[model samples]
Target chain A: MTEPHDLPSAAELVEAVREFLAHDVLPAVDGRVQFHTRVAVNVLGMVGRELALGPAQAAAHGEGLAALGVSSEAELARIIRQGGADDRMDDIGRFVRATVRAKLEVANPKYLAE
Target chain B: MSDGGRDAEPAALLRSVLDAPIENLRRLSGGASRETWSFDCGGRPLILRRDPPGAPKEGMAVEARLLRAAGACGVPVPEVVAAESSFIVMERVEGETIPRKILRDDAFAAARPALAAQCGTVLAALHRIPVEDFADLPDTDQVAEWRDILDSLGQPHPAFELGLRWLGENRPPRSGTTVVHGDFRNGNLIVGPEGVRAVLDWELAHRGDPLEDLGWLCVKAWRFGVNDKPVGGFGDYDELVGAYEDAGGGHVDRDALMWWQAMGTLKWGIMCIVQGSLHVSGTVRSVELAAIGRRVCENEWDLLDLLPYGRD
Candidate 1:
């Protein structure tokens, strides 16, 4: 089984699955299987993007909070878990501004994962 | 193999509608939580929106109700024909989803002011609609809401915590409560030669500070890679605000717009992270969704820069 990270681009992952289905699964299934292969293909494409980016984002977010004087990860976790209007702006707004600035500052030489 | 294979209940329900013929079904991308399809019915094009396989059951009615309200308010939205627990049928507007095409092409730049004007008019109109009609609407408490989402994700996200704190400390006083299209952005607006033909996607629509919509429109995420330009990645900030004001929105406070713009970036970043996690956990999987997740950090960084404290 290939790890999610090793799956290359979303297009490539989707193609690999299609090839597998055409060669292995299609032959075994009866005629008129009526699969919406296009939907599946699109879904996989979306999944590929998620796999490539999820961890890096989470990590960046953790780093951003620390920079903002958040004392501990646990506190931040608790805050997020409670999820209400704090006297503060919503988490969504803060993270976006911070992340965009970070990317602008350091286009991350190792950031080939897009 | 008639069109009844995938899910029997939905297909049967759809078939029951009068004059509903299965027109061509093509998946409309960009929604992680819902699956959207454009199909023709009885010679008229229509949209079918359904929850992705395992999405939560809440909010369907809210979306439908908001769309109805916006439609009543002269916002160019698809007409809601019918709605069920997991599915909604709507009139399909003829236009293209505003993408990099509008930004990259110089000809479209001329139409930016008009598009911005329409957006302002539509949004202001949406805000004017009486909120009393929607009885079960959620309150727009910033801190509490973020806290709840973080808890649901089941882990610590430092960026979120920091953002929450900053927002609380620098909370902008609400000017007035109005209907806010919680997710107004470039991709959500359908455009044509005339201008924005329709505003779609009401799932995140809510009642809150009207500036929230304005801020969302200017968010970097909606720019779709055109960082140099701000309004839907088409024109400058002044042009957008100018057009918005001309459309009877009155003078907008620059400070408030700035605050909301920053807020827009933060909100979108969190959503991207949540979607990314869903894909990672194998709950919901999509490459585009994951790619969006990767982009959240960039948005966060942008939000940081916008804040006074973020500057060196």
Candidate 2:
């Protein structure tokens, strides 16, 4: 293997475990077990997507914050709460929408599609 | 799904109250706060709503009174059988409360065409009830209340901040104060082929602006991913407004409703934070609540769409 952790990379391993639960365990279970198994599957799926997309998303998210001239999300939030951003509503709105989109990309991209 | 020998204490509570043998007691899923159990008592299908141990009992008693008040106003609601501080027994409502099923299932297709109007009519009827009659209901200044809640949660959600600012700045003058069904939405409705069978979940009922219920109903979360249909993914906004006005509700102001809608979306986003905090604080550990934390942005997306600042 090229790195310290051998072949089935972190993302690949999460996918393998998720698939095992979804395909092997989900079908055989019913009621509470079935529901929890599905949730577990979804959790892993989200983690896998984050591993694949998080780094680039972090970069894009920084750009989004820069568009609003805020150093951190908390600062942006405080400015809006205090009405300091009212004059620049259009710019702030654009930045908010883009960042929310990226967040859903990790959380649930289906939300963005709709 | 009869869970025999489980929930033994709750079953005993039912037996003592009804003085009849309880059978086929099984817990119903999907309620976030209250325990809902279905049981047969004296040849009647009843639902028992119990607060978790040590929780306040006054809420259940107040909810029972509100159900009767709404029913008196011709709103379809479950009939309360018996209500104590910690528990309430009501006639079990039989219909689907799941949004996706109510939106997609064939049985609801016919109901879908009429639900929006029915919802409007029902809300109008509900709003007609005298506010003074509900002496126990608390007044909620929602825009301010939710902001305080998000601030206390200490999580920075910028989208929520933007929407909250917009709502506060463009606050509409109060047209009327009425009985607002705070949690009225698609999922909280019991829908059948005929239409809405009963309105469930009155825990959030309060005294607020009459338009609040309508605005809350149209919140996109209740639409279940269907963006086109604005009113619960069932009927048009015109149908809802028309029916509401026709049913003795005052003139439906579009701008006021839109403002409330934006406010509703932000309130929901903050509520998601509160729910997630329950998990984070280890007060309640469940996958459902944890999953809701990530779902906050869904409402943020909807909130931004509602505000016309930067239309995408």
lDDT of 1 by residue, A3-104 (tens): 566645555766588667666766666623424343344445445444656568668867866664465556654554355424344444454355544443
- The candidate 2 chain A region of ten consecutive residues with least summed lDDT is A1-10
Chain A alone, TM-score for each of the models? Answer: 0.39, 0.90
**B241, model 1: CA deviation in Å?**
3.2
- Per-candidate Cα lDDT values, in order, are 0.67, 0.85
lDDT, candidate 2, at B190: 94
lDDT of 2 by residue, B127-223 (tens): 9877898967888788889888888998999888878877887898997989888988998899999998899888888898999999888888878
Worst 10 residues of 1 chain A by lDDT: A105-114
Clashes of each: 66, 0
Tens digits of per-residue lDDT, candidate 2, A6-111, equal 8889999999999999999999999888988898888788888899899998998888788778899999999987878778888888888888888899889877
**How many clashes (backbone atoms < 3 Å, residues ≥3 apart in a chain or on different chains) does model 1 have?**
66
RMSD of each: 8.7, 3.8
